[model samples]
Target: MGPTLDSSYEDWVRVAEGVVPPGRHRVGGREEDGAGAVFAVVSPRDGSTLASVADAGEKEVDLAVAAARWAFDSGPWPRLAPAERGRVLLRIADLVEEHRSEIAALISLENGKPIAESYGIELRAVAGTFRWYGQLADKVCDEAPHTDPGALALVTREPAGVVGAVVPWNFPLTLAAWKIAPALAAGCAVVLKPSELTPLSALLLGRLVDEAMEEAGVPGGVLNVVAGDGPTAGRALGLHPDVDVLAFTGSTAVGRHYLRYSADSNLKRVWLELGGKSPNIVLPDAPDLDAAAATAAWGIFFNQGEMCTAPSRLLVHSSVAERVTDAVIQRAEALRVGDPLDPATEMGALAGAARLDAVRGHIDAARAAGARLRTGGAPLDPAPVPGGTYLRPTVFDRVTPDMAVAREEIFGPVLSVLTFDTVEEAVALANDTEYGLAAGLWTGDLSTAHTVSRALRAGTVWVNCYEEGDLTVPFGGYKQSGNGRDKSAHALEKYTELKTTWIQL
Candidate 1:
């Protein structure tokens, strides 16, 4: 009925173990030793250490930045013809597809997403992103506005030089691909710093980049990856004077830090795709109330609810609130939560122990504030392995706009249901959040869909659907959700600088 697994869990597990080694960094196209400090790559499925990776620091960041600078200034990547570069990226895409099973397994272990989702969604996005950007590499056209015959004007674009891409633990490889593919397509060198919690997938991706580059007969050092926590290595990258631009996908707080980092250092262009408390509204006139409720449940519970654009806030029309909320609660409770490696699991563990506790704390705060605990709110046992953390899908009804659960991004499998009586109230409630990444509404009325969608302040609006998008459409947000698009041809703007030349006739 859905996307089937390419292989069994045991088969993927066997492939994951051999994907990459511990304490490795890919710098200047070579595997190099990280300084002595190290951190454990703890699997959220089980607290056991999958590998001990280098606890990257200032030294590692400096080395990676230097390598990227060199590559940008005097390497084959930036000098290659756009088509030639696209060929390399196509090779990378092919390689990714070839090793899809391995990367999927790695992501499931490092990030606690189900193996099926990892294979079907994350890895698929990664390969497709590279392929899309690759095909578009030579397709971008520079512009020159028409002028009088006395003057000749020309406009051109150049790579922005070194880019520092810092990604968080959730959807590690997928987010990395979003930044790397476009930056590379624009001929910009990159230094990637992956979150400490889930660095293995990114590390493996760096190796794959090198693999593709080697086959294309191109020089290395175009892309470098370093693994570490946010403060040490991430800050170093942010403050590095050599980085020409930085692209980050994480929390709004961290996005603010990167802004400050740019201001304090080179004043590099910083493009951020930050947090979201996206709202999914269900109107009384929805074409299919059943589908809307099911999608609402899926949106909040998918990926253990770690998505930036997760529909955490559910706004329903008063006329059908009870029926829709009950349907969603049923779906949430019925979701299969267990080992991430299981092919049949619909939900999986949180990142680790700390994440589990943080989610619990959010639930407790919601309870303290007097929100109704509708269906699921508790943590399941350490399953499949000791120390594994799985939280049951949680739903909070009768939630007020002022409540913590409704206002904050819990980043867990928690949904807050709020109600609206009229179109004006629904519009106000949806646009009330500080983060405007995405929003969805379900209705059958043509005018209502058009008018309401036009009124919503979110970057992407889906009518009668949720989280459905292709690579052609861009994704980003309005106000606090951060700046710039992550997909489509516009993403290249983040990695390139525009230059104008004017000559007298």
Candidate 2:
């Protein structure tokens, strides 16, 4: 019998300590790799040693890549009809929903997210992504451009061969699905490298994909999950000439590295979904101050504020800054930070120990830089549940643009409040960041919303709301936030190439 999705905190704790074996490299049809050293995966919840996971080093990376290459060149996956490919993807979505609770528990165990969030956000998105792309598969039609009467011109989209996808630890399965679903739907093979900190869930996903493909009369090697860190497995995939396209979701620095790797290798098409320092501007005439204030608190504290699209900087109009700031402080202080396995928990641990320390450093630096710490600037006292890497929800008011806390992507439950005198300054401050990933605006006037949204540099602008969108609209960023888009039918463009055919009669 398979290990169940443990219900109680005690049952989950048992699984965390090893009721289920840790994930491994799922290469080709093989589930084990003996080529590289094993790394210990630690649970930030209670500081227990989760398990030792086998690494996917250079040789293992090569093996996975080779499998993907072979699958693309000669396997039945690429050769199948578009509708058939879509059926496989649909099957994957069904399989994901069937095992939702188990996967959610596994993710919370490794990623240190609350179980409710794990189930609601990551798992929910994962299944939806597959379903959306699967439905879009056959709907994508080739184009026949108008030309001279005697001649015809045709444009058709084709799979771009093998893809190398690397996802970060923040939202493991959701981000992985953002890259994986579209590629598979487009008939492209992928070698997915999930962050070492959160590889277990991805490995589990790979197993389900294999099972889905087999049931759909497709080959099993269409996708591979290699568990390794950035330097080895990621770099290998980036520099490999065999990969036709590389899609990554991580830091801007790593995004730059992939571009360099592309230049150094066969000039593979590289698409990145990088870092963000998104702003949430609450104007004096906000449609509802209480609602905006609540969203601000939720935006900065959800998932322990590990979201790439998180509203990290709260820019308030000077007139309402104090009231809004005070309201947010009260909400932040009220958030329950405790055991992730516990149902009452509203917040969870940082991804791991290193992240906890780095967040503390950022908070300390903000203190030295003269930003007023209105609430929480240190680790939770007496340790919530003992040894868990839990930081108190932090808020900094009177923050200037130059402050590191205001400019940097802290990737934690840290919020910086800056006051803006006019709409011009608010727009300027929102557009000031090098990242153009996402931003939030709250205003009562529709014209201001329209004009300011157009003026802001972010790819996604949430008016009167934050972190809200569906798969129908494309999700991506501008400037240093990386290239290409994820979600929607536009995502297929990254994995498929267009070919032009000219005919003369």
Clashes of each: 0, 0
Lowest-lDDT window of 10 residues in candidate 1? 1-10
Q: Candidate 1 local accuracy as lDDT?
A: 0.90
**Candidate 1: deviation at residue 288, Å?**
0.2
Q: Where does the lowest 10-residue lDDT sum fall in candidate 2? A: 1-10
Task: List the global CA lDDT of all models.
Answer: 0.90, 0.90
Clashing pairs in 2: none
How accurate locally is residue 352 in candidate 1, as Cα lDDT from 0 to 100?
91
For each candidate, what TM-score against the reference?
Answer: 0.98, 0.97
Alpha-carbon runs more than 4 Å astray in model 1:
1-6, 16-22, 382-384
Expressed as tens digits, the lDDT of each residue in 205-296 for candidate 2 is 99999999778766667999899899888999999989999999999999999999999999999999999999999999998999999999
